[model samples]
Target: MKSSDISVEAKGVSKNYSSVKALDDLSLSVQKGEMFGLIGPDGAGKSTLFRILTTLILPDSGVATIEGFDIKRDYKSIRRIIGYMPGRFSLYGDLTVDENLSFFASVFNVKVADNYPLIENIFKDIAPFGSRRASRLSGGMKQKLALSCALIHKPSVLFLDEPTTGVDPVSRREFWQMLERLKTYGITIVVSTSYMDEALLCDRVALIKEGRVLSSDSPRGVIDSYQNTLLAIWGDDMHSLLKELRSYNEVKSVYSFGQEHHIAIDKKLYNHNYIDSLTQKLEERGERNFHIKVIAPTIEDCYMEFSANKEGYE
Candidate 1:
């Protein structure tokens, strides 16, 4: 991508805290006006990378830029053009919704009314409780209010760190919809989320683990890159089934999905004869009541695969 088209860039960025390595030479780029997702679990360095890019903290080594501004040198300029909503609620709990919003607006030397149009869609949801203290708001309402404050300055780039971690399912869906709307206004959104399902919502995603990016691509691209043949199997005796499958020589990997267990096998080893042999073996072992079928890989499946083979990825 051209320099002008990139909204965020990081190269070999690393951070260490005492004996812990928070980020290990991590690097990625976000395109302007695109929704980019950093998909990972806790302690995967998502938060650390966000802090480095937002200029809240400096990296131990490597370089990063936001809208072509050096993170270390042009931090003041970068701060003015980017909006950040931390993983935790940083707003004063004693402040009312309106007060919180107004305070943030004032900090940026702008009036809430001046950028009302930019956040009207999001603010309208919490406007009803404008006079209510932030501490009294629901998890969903608090997030909406936080998002409103982040956008009050009409920033060019927005960084959200696990914004829906504790939100209800309905609220999570609504928050994603709000993000979609923001894209239309030519704002670059870089959000970090641990929800595997949410990874599919981004235009592109970087599957990260242990301070490293195992894979980065569009959701479909990542799934398409999965080389293993996946099979979804389930039965009454899940524990026994899992143990049995793991003992099988052909099974490459197995994970407990929501209601079913997903197992990976070499594509070359997948065949009708193999299935028949496996079925017979299970039946002979007193596991007659079971079901198995080939299934398409989901983002979670891909993530597990990538995480298992992190050394193979750059």
Candidate 2:
């Protein structure tokens, strides 16, 4: 896409701390007004990338720009035009909710009333707690307050680093709903999360691992690219079933998925008769009452497949 259409762009960015590589040859782009996600596990370079894009830290090499402004040269400009909510609640513990909001607004040289329109929906839920110390707020309430502070400046692009990490299920859902509402206001959002389930909520996602980007695509695109013949198997003894499945030469990979085990098998070995053969083999191993069936792949499954493939290449 044209540079004007891009809200953020990272070109061959790399960072290292002594011997540990935090990011390596990483690159991705976020379109204007799009909700993009950096989906990966902890230490997968999501936070490092966020820090680079937000101009909190500079990359050892390569370049990144936010809103057409260079992250290094125009960091001051970038800070003014973008809102950032770090993974942790860094607001002052001694400050009340309203005081914290006012502090952030003052830093941005704007009154809370100036951008109240941007944060009104989120602040309303916490308005009654305006007098409560930030440290005394519940996890969900703290999250809402942090988001309100981030939006108090009406930034064009918001950077949220693992916004839902410590939140409850209900609050996580509510937080995503707030994001949906924010999108209508034409703000570009780049959120990083280790939760695989949240990938579906983004317009597009970049799957990162071990300081590199494995894949970047729409959620459906990633799932559709998983070519493995996955099988969901359940049995009397899940532990033994997992062991037996792994022992089979036909099984490429196997892992527990809730109560059942998901195994990836070679396409050549996946057939109608393969189930019967698998059952017979398991029966000889003293595994009985096991059921096996083909299953569709999920974003998690695709993530595993991509991660495994990347490992093989390395």
Candidate 3:
């Protein structure tokens, strides 16, 4: 297939360590110029997949390719075509932001001058502080600098692993905005994130757990896979509401979701009549300040159920 047809393709890949299976017959693919996301919490095999695709490690079995370059055999050309930013802040902290960017640019036989236009927008924000050590920059600035370096070589494919994990909310939002800009350049971008809300930002997402992909589709498609008529119940007494919700025989599953509680009920046993009865029961139990209503499933809800039966994390 052409690069335009498939930016990435993996078939029945597996990797193991002693008795632990880091990846279990996993397979995934991404189209050229598409911003694909891997959504899952830590230990979900995102890093493993990144390493395999980047040619940092060999898969014990199966095949993987980037723009049709076999990961193992065409690694040199593959490295030239892909820019990978790891989950950790791997940039040299003691080096100035400008220095770090220059170094990476040189590594790929490119210069800061060559790809200046590509990173011009993002670099302007931190260029004023260019002389500052990378260690001193705020999380968001460091993130931008790292991204600038990643693009300095103008790689066709980019892999970012949890790029916003430890950043503040504002920084996280800013980082995503940068990604949106990168997408406009028509480059294939694969990013892994632990935040459920971030899943909405992707053109499509793959929810992975314990080394296997549970579902791969557009964000809306994945969320719509949710089967239950979900409900979010909130109240002044959250603890009591949570306790009462899980104790109810009609409730199939209840998990705390930010400010509200997400619950899946057995429709056969619970309807308007059941909710009314449960509300009355709770009020009688001194949990009187709560409301429950039908709601659509969020990405988090779909991931929870989809990965519920997957193998436990290592």
Model 2 stretches astray by more than 4 angstroms: none
lDDT digits (tens) for residues 256-314 of candidate 3? 99899998875566566766777788898888678988888888888877765464541
For each candidate in turn, the TM-score is 0.96, 0.96, 0.95
Stretches off by above 4 angstroms in model 3 are 1-4, 309-314
Model 2 lDDT tens row, 238-289: 9989877877788888989899899998787788888788878889889888
The prediction achieving the highest lDDT against the true structure is 1
Q: What is the TM-score of candidate 2?
A: 0.96
lDDT, candidate 1, at 20: 96
**Native-vs-model 3 lDDT?**
0.87
- Which 10 residues in a row give candidate 1 its minimum summed lDDT? 305-314
Q: Count the backbone clashes (under 3 Å) in each candidate.
A: 0, 0, 0
Residue lDDT tens for model 1, 1-314: 78999999999999999989999999899999999999887789999999999999999999999999999999999999999999999998999999999999999999999999999999998999999999999999999999999999999999999999989899999999999999999999999998888889999999888887778899999999999999898889988988888888888888999789999999999887876788789998889688888899998899888777764632
Q: List candidate 1 segments past 4 Å from native.
A: 311-314
